[model samples]
Target: MVSGGINEILRAVEFILSKLLSELQSEDENDVEPKTKVRLIVPNGSCGGIICKGCATIRSFIEKSQAGIKISPQDNNYYGLNDRLVTLTGTLDDNKCFNT
Candidate 1:
């Protein structure tokens, strides 16, 4: 009975280690890419309400968005609205804006 219990514990430890190794491998693979670029056309105006305020300028909005930050512009404010009319072409990485 003691030996059997020890075997079971060892199996559990091995299973946990295998899972951790798999996750580590996946994380390494994901890290290989390092970053990706995506362009979005934001509306020229305040997002109002929540999630997107004070993001009046394209640069500011992009900076805030990349930082995983949120701002609240006034209701019906025209901050990010202009970008909608004119398309913005740029590159972004996992960190922030990247030069194309």
Candidate 2:
């Protein structure tokens, strides 16, 4: 009789755990954001790109903002002028924040 009671309790605990696990998984799936918005930061007439890759502020923003940033490949022409393509995983507001 005691063994039967222990087995019932164990099964109940397992059922409760499975329900909690599914709920937690659903919440995690909703928490992640997809990168859909794209913006191109054009270069200036002079040296450095609009978002200078070498700048400390830009690097810090990229690391924390969860946005994807790509600069034009360096070459003869792009070296003097660069274009920064920013892919925002969060929202359009992120670009304004980064620009400031």
Candidate 3:
């Protein structure tokens, strides 16, 4: 369960980094990095999710990343499941990530 959360976060980070790096290689580097988002279907209230320790861990990971990432619970639930949709939006600067 915990590994799944970690994998989700890793995928989001990879997607964002790849996008940022591609922008860096382009001719025009002035454009602001577009906001990136990752959605997940997590357990609902009946499963003690959306506020469980796993969710808290995800929040912590975002906070510690300091990459302008935000995670929030959406209003809608997953299709045909007792799961919820969670969105992880990122506003991290491309230069901050690729200017090394």
Candidate 4:
């Protein structure tokens, strides 16, 4: 037989546990985000072809891109240049926040 105070405490604990479990479950369902690949579409002018002539300009554009891109600090390699395709990898959102 439980005393009144102990019974009240147990009930409160059970209620808190139930609430926590529900919250966890809900978060699990809604917290998943899809990560995909994003590529740069170099326009015509000096930024076309496999070996782009405007490599510096393209690099500068990506460095200053409004899209939130997660780039490696050690990654200073030029992409879309010398017939090479460089890809940036990370999870991005509509706001362009890239995860490093």
**Highest lDDT: which candidate?**
3
Candidate 1 lDDT at 47 equals: 30
- What is model 3's C-alpha RMSD? 6.8
Candidate 1 lDDT, tens digit per residue, 13-46? 4465456445655667756433322233334353
Clashing pairs in 4: 68-96
Among these predictions, the greatest TM-score belongs to 3
Residues 24-91, candidate 4, lDDT per residue (tens digit)? 55666564443334443323332343224655544554555433333222223666433222344433
TM-score of every candidate: 0.26, 0.36, 0.40, 0.26
lDDT for each residue of candidate 2 in 1-100, tens digit (9 for 90 to 100) = 1135866866664455456445655666664432244444544432253355567655756677655555544455545544444443443322334243
The lDDT per prediction is: 0.40, 0.48, 0.54, 0.42
Minimal lDDT window, size 10, model 3: 91-100
Residue 57 shift from truth in candidate 4, angstroms: 70
Query: After TM-score superposition, what is the CA distance of residue 22 in candidate 3 from its true location, in Å?
Result: 2.9
Please give the lDDT score for candidate 4.
0.42
As for lDDT, the candidate ahead, 3 or 4, is 3
- Candidate 2: pairs in clash: none
Clash count list over all predictions: 12, 0, 0, 1
- Cα deviation at 86, candidate 4, in Å, is 52
lDDT tens per residue, model 3, 16-49: 6677557654735565655555565665663343
